[model samples]
Target: MINLKISEPNPRESVREYAYRILSENILDLVLVPGAAISEKEISDVLSISRTPVREAFIRLSQEGLLEILPQRGTYVSKIDTEQIAEFKFLRITLEQAVMKLACSDFPQKLQEQLCNCLEKQSICVKKRNHEQFFIFDNMMHDIIFTGCEKSYIWKIIQEANLNYARARVLDLSSRQDEIEVLFAQHKEIVKAIITKDTSLGENIIVRHINKVISDVDDLQKQYPEFFK
Candidate 1:
């Protein structure tokens, strides 16, 4: 098993919240990694927080599907459940496409500018070959697009679902230069489609983008079946 290292806590963070964010990010980034065993005391000591907060965080993460609490075996970073990932992908694509369609009809100038900035950052990340930052910007781009649709509740659900699938998508980032380039091109097209109020074009591009991620998951599962549940 990999030895997970937790960071020192910030003075401003509540112990339970800090533990939650740290553990959640680690899981999404695959740093704690899937199927890894976890000890509350070990995490508490490493983060310099008490076991109580760590336990609270564990329970929260378990509720979020990021942790598995086995009775005698103890808590573990949850395995990658392909079925869940598929469900997440389906929901994200379906809801996000609907949002894009709505945004196409009622394109707002402010939202477009925000999405433009995100796309700019995405370009910079690509130029620098910074995968982590690229992913962050990619998320911002989607956030701007989806949140602009005024469907806040659905947008929030998409965020949680995307987090569940993000690690697998990130793993597929290595040496995916051509695919990455196509993504930026598609982003531009999507933006243009929205700007021109072309709902069909926007829907098509977003659907293709999401399907590509699903395809990548298939590639990953084939390459490393052990990493998945």
Candidate 2:
């Protein structure tokens, strides 16, 4: 097992959620790759916790289809399911598109300020070549949109549905440099649409934004055949 060190568990974060966040990020980043054996004891030991929380994390990952827990064979990272990718991408895009439509009409000034700040931070991350931070800010921007529409529950479901999307995003960031460069500009455009209450423009941009991954899957499959199913 690779050496793992997590930050001191946050007081507000339940053990299981902390463990889940650490393991989930590693899995998504391809550090703990598909088909690799994962030991609950090892992880719990790293986190300086009992096996219970690690096991809880394992159960959650299994439910999200990010890990396969076999009774006799031991737990291993699950191969990326392209089908799940398609389904969840469709679901997320649909939800976000709806959110944009709702949020665009009378888009609150405070939320607009938050989104613009997010976009600015995203621009900085992209310029600094900090792909990880860029991804984090990207999600924050979207979550703000969802929250603006009073659909926080929808954002939770999107997060749960995003295992494959997360992995694919890593690939997307690594490979699509030119388009990634444009993403900040695109984010600005999205915010502009919202500020002006232009739902049609927002929808159009979001569709292209969300579909970029699906459009590039062939290249992803060619690059990492083993990661895909």
Q: How does model 1 fare in lDDT?
A: 0.81
Compose the digit string of candidate 1's lDDT tens values, residues 24-44.
878887778777889898887
- Residue pairs with backbone overlap in model 2: none
Candidate 2 error regions (>4 Å): 12-14
Candidate 1 TM-score versus the reference: 0.90
Predictions: Cα RMSD each: 2.2, 2.0
Q: Which residue pairs in model 1 clash with each other?
A: none
Give the worst 10-residue stretch by lDDT in candidate 2.
Answer: 1-10
Prediction-by-prediction clash tally: 0, 0
Candidate 2 steric clashes: 0
Give me the candidate number with maximum lDDT: 2
Query: How high is each candidate's TM-score?
Result: 0.90, 0.90
